[model samples]
Each structure stands twice: as structure tokens, then as C-alpha cells.
Target: MTVFGCRSCDATLTVPVSRVALPVHADQKYGNRPGSLAPALEPGTFAVNPLPSGPPWRRWAELEPGEAEALGWYAPRIRISAGPVGQVLLAPGDVRGAVIDPALVSDSACCGIDGGEPNMVCATCGTPVAIRIDDCGLRQAVWLAPLTTHVIGDDLGPHPVLDWADLIDHRPGIPPSEPGGGWHPMWAAAAGAALAHLLATSGGEPIVIPDHQVADVFRPTLDRLAGPGRTGPERTLVLAGPGLPDADGDLALIPQHPQTGELWPVAPPVRPVPLAWDAWRHLAFHRAPKPVGRSVPIPPEAPLALLPGPRFEPDGQIFLSVLARLPEVGQPWLRAIYDRGRPYSYTFHVF
Candidate 1:
């Protein structure tokens, strides 16, 4: 009686049957509400056919001659996206920055958008706005007007799209070394660490100052610490203030390279004072000594390799790269890259 066999062969197989049949209506099958179909479609059909009429004609005669000419030469189109918000626009590669149009701000709460923190309102409108990453993978700068217009609750508004051209000429809050170029990864990282350290140690408030000015005060101090024959680590300098712990007293000044993770001892001549944004500036820029000799006699036709970029560290001490260009002899220039929320840059030179 107990013989092993296939379920079908033993006549023991059972199959469940459904009572519901597939829907025939397009809306029913597609589970779409009425009027949800695209304008190009017909009822009960999934196929899309071209209209008998060609492309819609615009009356060219209505446009001014100058406007028509301008249209013909308009820049190439670029796609920009911020989560659900996106648009395509023609822009020149040289554009400096984008201006967020005020119209895009939504008055009502946009559901499904998540602001990073609770209680944070949208920067554009007063409602709680969600975090939306911009379409361009590159970080962008924010314009105050559009941000304030569409802020929801306390959430910051989206950064504006930048015109690459304009940024090349403008000065950023932290100017990079080259025009339209970013800093070396090591230096950038170091600067970021320095900033983070300032924030963590300073009760969340970090002071920002000009990069060159910070270097002027710190460079001499660093050089003395390295001693003779010891080249300084490639470093990036950042300024933060207000709440940073006392460098000499409450805090310890431990300098390290961002990339190589090399530890450099804090040298004298560069004393760590309390975090004071204005004081740093005054010491770096206002009090910097002028070179005594005639242009430090740059040897004619001598080729010298520039110093590598600064390195960043997770702990926030930027290891500045000491290049062949010496500030003591020649008028060496220093700059910082300003990333305004997004990766935007402008250069400032220190003579």
C-alpha cells in the first residue's frame, strides 16, 4: 500500500483555482486612474503612433530678429536634477554660476522628501522641505535669493547651478590654487579634517578665514619646526574660529599629513594661539614682513618643479606641501578653494 510514486501519477495532486479573470479595460489592467494616460495614447492600446501632422509649428515671425539670432546660437543643453526636481537648459561651459529661478519653490509640503534632521524646515519655503541631491554629480554653489525663496521650515534650499566660466574669474571663500581647478586631493582632505577638528572641538562653530592669510601666520612657524634640511609636509591650511579649544593650553597642536598619514611635530616660531579669526588675519596679512632683497634673485632660465598639493587628515591638521617656491626669497602665491556647499572654486593670491 505504501508505494512511492509521482504526485500526479498517484492522483494526489491538487491545484488551486482563481475566480478572478484578467481585466479588459486599459485603466483596469494598467491600474491607472482616468485621464492618467499620456496625451499621445488612445484608449485600450499600448502602441504609440506618430500624428499625421508634423512637428508643431511656432510662428517665427513673432520673434524679434535679435532674439531669433540669439536662439540660433544658444548654448548646448545640460540636464540638471535634484531628486524629483529636474530640468534641461542650454548653458555655456564658461558659465560662472546658476541662478535658481524663484518660481520652482513649492508652497505646499512636498511629501517623500526627507530633510536630514527633524525640525529642519525648507530653506526656500517655510515648510519642512526634503533633502534633494542635485542632478549634476558635482557639488554646486547656492545663491541666497532662490534658497530663501523656497525654504521649507528650516531646511536649506538647493544650491544653484554654476556657470563654469564665471567661477574661473571670481574669488571663492577658500580659493583654490588654480583657476577653474580643484586642490590636490591630499590638501583638500587635510583642510576638511582641520575644519572638522575645529567644529568638534569648538562646540560646532568653526571660523573661516582667507587661506593665504592663514598660511602667512602659520608658514613661518611651521618652517622653524621642520628645522634645517627637513622639508615640511605638504599641507592645506583652513581657518575656523569662535569656539575652537585653546591650541597652546586646552588643546594640543599635532600636525600630520592627510595622505601619507605622517606625523609632524608642531615647531616653534609658529605658536598656537587661541582660535581668533581676525587675529590670525592680522598676523598673516597685515603684519607679514616684506622681503628685503631685490626679488631674491631668481636664477635666469632655471627650471624648478612646484611643490605638491597639501594633504588632509581625518583629524584636521592640514600638511602643507613646501614647494621649491620659497616665500622668504620670492613673492610666493597661495590660494584656497571655496566650496560653497557644492564644489565651486575661486582663487585668491597672497603676495
Candidate 2:
């Protein structure tokens, strides 16, 4: 079963069975959210057209009589006569036509703890400062888990550049001590390069740079990309190392091309991942033997089990409905499959 919510009235609806058994289709009349299985009312069913400027659910009750009748006729229902695999009954008077309420129903749950302590206080005034500890025990618990262990060799050096290169070469097998490996100068350069690429591809938006001095190196490149005769916005730049300006501090730089005026940071050298024999040799020598997880099964056809019906709104309106049932472990894989199936929406929604 799947649940859908109406943004207007906050009304939620759940399709109780798999949609694959039905001959109905999915509708997108109400934005991109999940649609209902109810049909729209026919022409001349009401005294006035329900096409108002109000929200979608609000227009449901205003449907014409004939249209409303048509909607009522195609409302979804489960027949008891067919045993467990029951028939779909599309009738207006059914209570099952009502959309469910999400607020009243709990969707998911997790375990955690709460705190009531103040961690910081003013040195002179002695004013208590409120503090929030997001994950109290969960983080520490996971860190302490008895997973596969690695013995660190004495050959580990102090250089950041060599360490990072070595780390990348050995990843997907051995876990690095730090998430991004201990800070190194080469790491800083790589970070600068990545930041530059992001800014360039960001479609002319002025982004804050972390390293002002290094950013100064890339300004000309950014200006050329921004085009000529545009006054750029003032953005802050922060350097990563200590003795640098705090987050609140602002450092400004004048634009070189005053006429173009499009201020931008210097472009960092974003070197591509070298596929040379030396790089491959480094991996072959130091790569660790990490155990990989088993692969899950993938269906050749539709990955999700879909349900079908006429769609509807909270105010008793109708549209087409389709459902997608996915496996617990293969969600991403199945989602990729469904995304590829987007062009077939017409065929899937109708039949």
C-alpha cells in the first residue's frame, strides 16, 4: 500500500492493493504528487464550472452535477465477492473514497534521547547559554562498533599531499582514519579546484570562496565566464587554516575588469584523476583487501509493483492513479528503472 497527501487540505489517501491488477492509469493533474483513481465528472453535470483560482482540493465540491456523477461512478472500491483478490468497485458513495489523514497516522519511527544542560556561559556576566546536542549516544555507539580492524603501519608520514593520494588509491577497501584524511596542502589545492569548478558550473551566481588568496588566482577565468559589463555582487571568502578570519569576518577584492565588473574568484587547477600507469601501480601495491557486500536480485521488467485506478482529490474530485511497489534493499536500483520508464507513462496510466 502507498500513501499520498493533499497539499491544500492535508488530506492523505492510501491505495490498499497493488495497482498492477487494475486497468486504470496514473494522472498528474494535481502537480507531481500521487494521483487518485476516481474519474472526472462529465459535461453538464453541474450548474457552474468548478475551474476556480483556488487550490485543487477546494475545487472538488464545485464540480458540475454530471461531472460529479461521472466521478462518483469511477471511485475506487474493493469487492468482497472475489475473496482475497477482490474486484475493484468504482462507486461514489463508498467511504473508502475518503482521503486518509497523515497527521493522525505515524509514518516512521526511530530511537534517541533528550538533554537539558547548558554548555556555555558568559565569562564576566555569567549568563547561561542554551546548547543543543543532536546525536548524544548514537554517534559514539556506532564509532565503538566491533567492525573489521586495520593495523596502522609505522611508515605513515606527516605530508598531506602524499597521504591524500595514497588514501584515494586505497579507498573502497581500507577505511581512512579521517573522513577526508588529515588536512594537507595538496588537499587544500584539490578543495580549491573543486570549489572553482562548482562556481563555474553554477550559472553565474556569486558564491562564497573559502580561500581568498588562492581565489585571487582564479578571478580572470570567472570574469571571462560571466561575460562583460556586469557589476558583480560582494561575497565573502574564508581561508581554511588557523589565524584566518572567522565566519563573521568579510574580506573584499576589487574587480580587475571595471567595465565588465563581474567580480569572481580565481580558478583553481582541477587536475583530472590520472589514469597513468604510475597511478594504477600505486593502487596495485597498497590496496587493502576489504570484503564487499553481496549483490541483490534485479527484475528485468518493471522493478516496482504498480497499482491502477481513477485518481481523485480530497474535495471529492477524480483523476487517474498508479502505484509503485518496491523492494526494501533495491530502492535506488528500482528508482533508476522507473525513471527510464517515464516515457511510457501514457500507456501505463491508461491501461
Candidate 3:
């Protein structure tokens, strides 16, 4: 198990935990309302890396031309992000000697505590240690202050992600809305990232996700982004991932290895169109039950609601990151989407 401590004083700060791949919520906006359920982290696991948009970032405009080129970017229009120093994530229970200063809490979010900032200070040396996020409708976690805490314990080298065969029956599920009553960010993030890949690999053709759920989730944003007129072949987006059906279709949203971000290869081999592990699994399990189940497991208080309630906007950065990696960014259709600046402004309901 890995342990983190104070970098300045070497005082232990985090409980011993195993290293885990970065979570989808690592950069997620938590708490749409005061009483939402804050998602919990897996016990004894930690993500010691900063998520995109996490602290310790410099804007592209802040760098000189040589510095920007040194950072491996030919363009400065996009946000240049790097891992923050001393950042760590773990379950709230794993935190030690950290106290929530009530005064540090935000006035805007009062339903549950919104510790979005570094609200927890180390009781030992008075250093800002972490952020305790346990607000309703969001994931509960302790976001360690970068440059304050230090990690102690054996460093595990990068672990290979679970292969496709192992996840065939391990698909995950996501809620349409947050607990406190707001749209879930995962849908939009997923759709945006998926749209990026779809356009990048579309071969100049219009794409379609036959699955009503997926189409409903993505089509609005994609159509708006793809623009009104484009003459080309039609591509199909199908749920194709590990242990699932063959991706004989034009385009497949394959699952990336949860740990490694490695995409499950299509039979004949194709450019990777991987989704973040969680999102991929959500799509993979959208309709079919896990192969091992006779019926999907229902949460104790599952909401009996109609499908496709409302689509919320995705995290803009995540969407951009997904799209920016593709060469298709220069394409007229893709350029239009990029130009929208705030793609989330478009309102579409999933339910």
C-alpha cells in the first residue's frame, strides 16, 4: 500500500492505499444540490495524479513561444495542463489529522458540504492538506493539496489494465441525473469525447449510433457540431467493446483498459476509438445485462423513471481534450464544433 505524508515535515497524511487508475470523477464537478449523494472512492486505493484542469496548470498564453514549443505544442490556443505536484486522492476515511474549517466552506453550496477547494488543513503543522468533498449529488473524496503532502511507501510501477476478456461481463452503470437533481456530467463528457473520435475517424462521412440510447445521448451535440450540410458516406456508431459483440460496424466505441487506457482491438484491427473505461462500460451495458446476470441488479432505492430524461452539458475541457488529439480538428465540421467555445450551452434532455 502507498502512503502520503507532508512534503515539508514528512508527517504522514494519508492512510496506506493501493494505486488505482485515475477515476472519471477525478475532475468531475460535484454537487448540483445540497443533498446529493457524494460518490465514494474504492477503499484503500488512491490516484496520486492530477486530473485535467486540476491545479498546477499554466494557461497557454502564459508561456513564451520557446517554452510552448518545449512543452510539445505547436499551437497555444488550447489549454496546456500538467500533473500537479504532491496531489493525491483517497477515500475520506483514509485522511488523517485533517480538519474541515467551516469558514473555508463555500457559501454557494450549502446542501451538503462543498469542499471543492482546499478546505482541510493538516492539524499537525497547519499546512493546507486536502479538500474533503462529501457533498450531495457528487463523489465523496479527499483531494490532497499539491505541494503540501508527500507520498510514502513502495511505488508500484504502472500496472497493466485489465484485458477485454475480463470486462466482458463487468460493464458498469451510470445514473441519468445527480442525486440532488441535475444532469449527470458523464453523459455529455462521454458524448463529446465520442464525438471527437467519431469525427476524427469518420473518414468524412456522417456517423450514426443505431442504439436509441446512445443516439439520444449523442446525436444532438453531434448534429449541431457536425453542422447543417455535409455530403459524405454514413458511418455507424455501435457499442463494441471487450467480451461484447464484434465491431463489424463502421465505427465502434471500444473500451479502453481501465488502468492503462489501452483500447480493445477490433478483429481486423482499426484505429483506436476508446472511451474512458467507465463511459465505455456504461455504453456497453446500456441495453444488455451483464452476461452473468439474469436481471440487472437494482439499487435499493432505484428511481422508477422513464428513459432519456434530459441531457446535461459535458465538461468542456474533457470534450476538448478528446477532440484536440485528432487531426480532424482542422476539418470544417470539427472546426465548427470547436468554435462553439461553450458546447454545453446547447440544451438537450436525455430522458
* Model number with the top TM-score: 3
Clashes of each: 60, 34, 19
* Model 1, runs deviating above 4 Å: 1-182, 205-212, 215-253, 257-351
Deviation in Å, model 1, residue 314 alpha carbon = 14
Off by over 4 Å in 2: 1-192, 197-203, 206-212, 249-351
lDDT by residue (96-186, candidate 1, tens digit) is: 2122233443333232211111222233233322122122111111111112122112221122222322222231222223343533222
What is the overall TM-score of model 1 with all chains considered together? Answer: 0.18
Top candidate, metric lDDT = 3
lDDT of 3 by residue, 277-316 (tens): 6666665665533346548776534433323455445555
lDDT of 1 at 2: 13
In order, candidate lDDTs are 0.24, 0.24, 0.62
lDDT tens readout by residue for model 2, 1-351: 322222223232212211111111111122222223222211111011111111123133444554523433112222101111111221122112132222322222123211222222223232322111223211110000001111112232222222323433433221112244432122222222333333323323454544323333334334433444544664544331111222342332211111111222333421111111221132224233333583864433322211111211111011111112112112343233223333223332211
Clashes in predicted model 1: 60
